[model samples]
Target: MTPPHATPVGPDLPMPFTHAGVDQLVSIWLAQLDVIRDLAEELTAEQWAAASPCPGWSAGDVVAHVLALESELHGAPLTDHEPDWAALPHITSDFGRLTERAVDWYRTKGQDVVVAELIEITAWRRDDLAHAWNADSDPNEVVTGPLGLELPRERLIRTRILDTWVHEQDIRTAIGIPGGLRSDAAWVCAGQFAFGLPYVWGKKAAAPIGATLDLTVTGPGVSFERLVQINENGRAEFIERTATPATVSLTLDWPTYAAASAGRLNSDSTGALVANSCRGDDQLAARLMPALAVTP
Candidate 1:
């Protein structure tokens, strides 16, 4: 909620955060755990390996990713967090146990830093966004996260919420959890990324050479703005967006939007999402589809 890292318009958009945004994110965060619990109740080892929205990953990989992150949360000492240990062992057994060691490490952050701490790191991580959107800063800049370019903290929280909720749905969908995307978390979780499609797809080339496009959501929620890159880089920025929307609206449900953001959903599968936009002209959204379609 402080000033965003930077801003120069790429597409026609809205402000990134609001108070409701926090609630939406929190809802998704909590819902992720609840749904994962449901998955545990309904699924088995065989089912865990079922394919997920993520192209190469299965339900097991998804679980491994979540559990691995939790393991990190508990302060597991990583020789290198880069290529996560999830990819280490050829067999699943070693993979599971090594990460379990990561989890055990968190239990004792100070007392040997492994078993004695015994703290629930998820709750602690949740606290990072408590006041994220508390500001009404007039001009926000894009900040960097641990990895890529950083979004405003507030927007970042929304994406996190969106990520948790959407992946939860992916797991649920794989295991036959009914009524996916039923909560407020689904709307904000999905919408948060939809609004910022332009920023994430900044480097891609647009299909439409000279066209204006927009990605307005079909349902409710006041508009928030962000920009996109439309034309080739190094040309005048405004002229570029006028040629095409480097940014486009994401209008599908929580599951599809999440999958699309992860780079999994093809355009055919995303229904009613860009219902009003110029399809051929909005290459940014689709170009970004690969990353959003899976968990990277």
Candidate 2:
């Protein structure tokens, strides 16, 4: 059940990647954290228990997940905790189980406690990030991210912004207070997800070579038109213009685009498919839609 109020437009497509400095990205990440903190602080006990879009996670659990990650980033020591996997069937991957350990630890505490921890941890993270990097810093400088992955400094922060914004939306949707769909963080997150469409079409969906798919995202904030063609090398790439007609064309709103790209539309409960208008080759569109989720 996608909320009726969730249909807000995002910023234009192809975000200013080259110009987005580390400081700016951190600011966006901080803004997302502020939104999440506010949402968590106002939640009632019953609302905290509400089921979120994330499998087996309550609204409070989502906050806890955010808090846990930030706490780790803030240099908090990891607790010796392991969830009983047999009792948690919703966890289907090693990564899920790993993240669940921290989330489950907070489940033993009160909701207010979780909110307080989130506030404290996020505040600390904000201060640390302010001093850690700056606009003039090398964006390509390698930094460690979660799971021991080494990523460029800018990419690591952008990933945090995307994750924080998405989780904020999860909390908002769970408690029926949908918003933050048009924030700066929202646009960044949307663009990051949209950037993955090439991989989805090329490798995941396996669109036929020489076929072109036109994707138009209608947004008041995060809107963009893209034409992706499978080139002779059997690779999908975005092109500025094309003379050949598209084999498939898909139009969707920003919210629907984000939801689908985030893998939230895979469940029938989201009702997100109803919002997408597809044309041209039906078979190709079918293949593409299922492969749209580029996030793990």
Best-fitting candidate, measured by TM-score?
2
Q: Report the lDDT tens digits of candidate 2 across residue range 205-254.
A: 78889888788778645666777888899998887656677888888877
- Candidate 2, residue 89: how far the Cα is off, in Å: 0.8
The models' CA-based lDDT, in order, is 0.45, 0.79
RMSD to native for every prediction? 9.2, 4.3
Off by over 4 Å in 1: 1-17, 20-28, 79-156, 200-210, 216-254, 266-295
**Window of ten residues with lowest summed lDDT in model 1:** 110-119
Deviation (Å) of 183 in candidate 2: 0.7
Report the number of clashing residue pairs per model: 41, 6
Residues 157-183, candidate 1: write the lDDT tens digits. 555556556667666656665454445
